[model samples]
Target chain A: MLQYVLKRLGIAILVAVTVSMITFSMIYLSGDPAIALAGETATQEDIQNIRRVYGYDQPIVVQYANWLWNALQGDFGQSHYLKKPVADVIFERLPTTMLLGACALIFALVLSIPLGVVAAVRPNSLIDRIALTIAVVGQAMPSFWFALTMMLWLGIYWRLLPISGTASWANFVMPSIALGYYITPAVMRLTRAGMLEVLSSDYIRTARAKGLRPMTVLFKHALRNAIIPVVSLAAVQFGFMLGGSIVIETIFAVNGLGFLAWESIQRADLPMMQAIVLVLSFFYIILTFLADMLNAWLDPRIRVM
Target chain B: MAERVLEVEDLCVEIPIPSGMLRPVQHVSFHVGQGETLAIVGESGCGKSLTSLAIMDLLPSKAKRRAERLVLDGDALTGMTERQMADIRGNQMSMIFQEPMTSLNPAYTIGNQLTEAMLRHKSVSLAEAKDRAVWLLEKVGITAARSRLGQYPHQLSGGLRQRVMIAMALMCGPDMIIADEPTTALDVTIQAQILHLLAELQDEFHMGMILITHDLGVVARVADRVAVMYAGQFVETGTAAQIFDSPTHPYTQGLLECIPIPGKTERGAHLGSIPGIVPSLVGEIRGCHFAGRCPYVHEACTAEDVSLRPSLDAGHEYRCVLSPQAAIANRNKQAAQ
Candidate 1:
């Protein structure tokens, strides 16, 4: 088990390094960073001075090494627009995004797992149709549109929520719903399909033949096996929620890393963009690693392998 | 006779599909006494497994199981609610399935699956259940039983897992066990061992067993009574000796002839075979279900339904148009020709 975990961790580190390298290359890929940093009116000499000051004149290998060394120490350089340390700006906004991501995931699982199980338990029944309709609507409607509708009704009309700030937990209700509901369809469908398959398995027959309570058979035996793949899906969705929160953050003024990313892109703050992309990519890799571990723990077949 | 552990009468299972209502098990009835093994032998899709599942009240949701009476030790299972049936299941009666590789939950440890039934039905503590699990596992011939408890299903081989399944079925100490093709998925060598273990355990526990299988050899070796089923009905049923020695029904006789008789059958000669496939049970099924395949099939055979009729021997019966004497004379005439 320990060796499996160590191996997963090694792969995770390899992925993070590749992501970091890609994030670092984004600056070069977008043409000269010095030219982008300097004003359009600036002469060649001005561009050269900017390049020298930022050490862009050095070979690409040395430049990458220096940036990687500093990034290793959490020194992500300064934001060109805000004139603040990139890491500070990113870390400051990270908590809200993380909290939002966690809540969104919780809401998605809490709402969809039972729905999926119920739908699967009695397929083609009324409740199953209702759940399927909800899933279809959730999948069809765009998140931004859903967010706007919620903001209009809950924030403007009903005065039920504070829709545009991260002052309290209540502020996240609309955004989380919009973000979480978007992926609920996939998660719920996977769960329903999985449960349907697992519920028909010989083990479930054995479980029923054992005279286990319906709840025990459904939750303990059937769900435990069915939820394995869903766990990995949920992890991937969580990573997606974190990265895709840019639109929601923009609309609600949550001021998370997503909003920071939008601002940096617009203002040509390459350092902040690099840090945000790298950080989010790292989160994605780490989440996938944890999911692998969790799956291995849940299913012994994977553990022995 | 020993005390009757189970009495099922006129049990029918019908499944409705897009085409029509499919009657897979038609008015099948049998009883099993304490410590007796009544093996229901048939080809695949002959509704043998469905009969066992119907008795256990575990049919698919859409499939309707109707029975005149399903009594387990004086308890009427037909009218019991699902909750009441659940209480009786795995307590008064339990089942063992064919595929041990898939019968045990992969995510759970052998210990959890073994003890869960006992824990649910009895008021015993977890420790007590665990102890019973260990004892049962060892009784089923699994060595290092205590260590085997913590291991998951995939950790064990097919044979070992089947032993665990047998141990699990015995955990609650039910009076009746319905083993549906229990050794069908086992290795050839392992098949004998599993059968031996089951026989030993049944003897020790004195539980009435309904052994469902397609293996005539298994039925001959272990079954006290045997029911030969065709399509959705029992074509013949009697003491094992009667069915094997003097199979009166054309279907039963044909089945026995298919098996090679060691030195009796020529080494390179053609083996016996019953011509034609089983008829579909959809819509209305007239006459004997095996009429198409029976060598003596006549015009009248397909004109009406065939029901089980008694032979000269007590408790022996077969479903055929001809009388026992006539059927035997006809077989002898054919053999002489």
Candidate 2:
């Protein structure tokens, strides 16, 4: 197990490096950052001075290597527009995104598992038909569109909820729903398929023959086996939630890493953009690693290898 | 004779299909005397397993059952709710399934699975349940029962798993056990060991058992009474000795003849094979269900439906168009030639 963890950590470092290089180079793929930062009216000498100050005048590999080295030490240089440390900008906005993502994941799990089990238990019945209908609608509708629709109906038409701003817990309700709704279908479908497969296994029949109640047969014996596949799926979905929080954050005016990343792009702040990309990529990698470890712990067969 | 422990009368199971309604079991009736081992023998798809499932009230939710009576120790079980049936299962009546590897839950330790029935139906503390589990495991001949409790199902071999299943079934000391092809998935040597274990356990507990299998050799060794099923109905039932000595129904005769013996060969002794497949359950048949496969195939055999009739012996019974004297004469002549 220790060897397994070490091997996974080694792979994680390689992944982090690749992600940092791509994100750092892609920010430069567009027009020159100095022109965008110094404005059109600035003189040629002023632009050159700005470029030299930010180390852009150096070789691309040298600039990248320096930036990566500094990033490893938690120094992300300074933000061009804000004129503050890049790490400060990211730190100021991380909590809101983490809260929204966590709530959305919890909501997805709480709603989807029971719905999936009910659907699998009574296939083609009224509850099953309703669950399938909800799954189809959830998958078909995009999160941004769903958020806008919720804003229109719940905020504008009914005046029941706040429309924008992430000031308090109330602000998280609509955006979390929009994000949670989009992810619930995948969880529901996976759980439904997994539970159906387990319900038909020979052990479940033996459990029933042993006189276990139907609910016990379902929740105790069938659900544990069914949950093995769902754990891996949940990990992937959680990573997607973290990275995909951009649209929902923007819609809600929540100042998260996604919103910060968006502002950095408009201003062409290279250090801030690189910082946001690196941090988010790191977050994704860490989450995937944690998920792998959790899955191994939950199922010993995987750990045995 | 001992008092009857279970009486199943005219039990029929109908399953709906796109083609039409299918009757998987039709008017299947039998009884288990206290401490007696009644073996129900038939090939696959002959409703042997279905009969056991029906008795346990563990049939699939889609199946519809109609029975005149299903009594267990004089208690009615025909139309009980699932909860009530559950109360009886594992406590009064338990079952051991065919595939030992799959019968035990893979995720649970052997001790947990063995103690589940005991804890569920009886008011035993966890410690007491554990002790009982170890005791039962040792009774089934599993070595180091205390330590074996911590191991999972995959850790044990096929024979050991079957013993675990038997121990689990007997944990609560159920009055009757329904063992469905208990040793079918094991090797020949393991099969003999399991069969002996089941027989020994049954005698020690004085428990009634209904062993469902298609193997005549198993029935010959373990069964006190035998019931031969064909096309979803019983064609012959009698003492094991009587059925082997003189089988009246053509299906039973065919089944007995199919068992191969080592180092045995006779001229014109074609390995006996039942001639035709079991008929589909969709449509009603006007005549005998086995008429298509019977070697006799008399014109009257196809023209009339035949129900069970008593043989010359007091306890033996069979369902056939031909009288017992004719069947015996036919068997004697075939053996002589």
Best by DockQ: 1
> What's the distance in Å from true for residue A163, model 2?
0.9
Q: Ten-residue segment with the worst summed lDDT in candidate 1 chain B? A: B328-337
Candidate 2 overall Cα lDDT vs. reference? 0.87
Instruction: Judging by lDDT against the true structure, name the best candidate.
Output: 1
Off by over 4 Å in 2: A1-14, A17-68, B266-269
Instruction: Give the 10-residue window scoring lowest on summed lDDT in candidate 2 chain B.
Output: B260-269
**B-chain TM-score, candidate 1:** 0.98
lDDT of 2 by residue, A154-173 (tens): 99999988989987788888
The candidate that achieves the highest TM-score relative to the unseen native structure: 1
Per residue, candidate 1 scores C-alpha lDDT tens digits across A53-92 of 9999999889889999999999999888898998999899
The positional error of residue B70 in candidate 2, measured at the CA in angstroms, is 1.2
Kindly report which residue pairs in candidate 2 clash with one another.
none
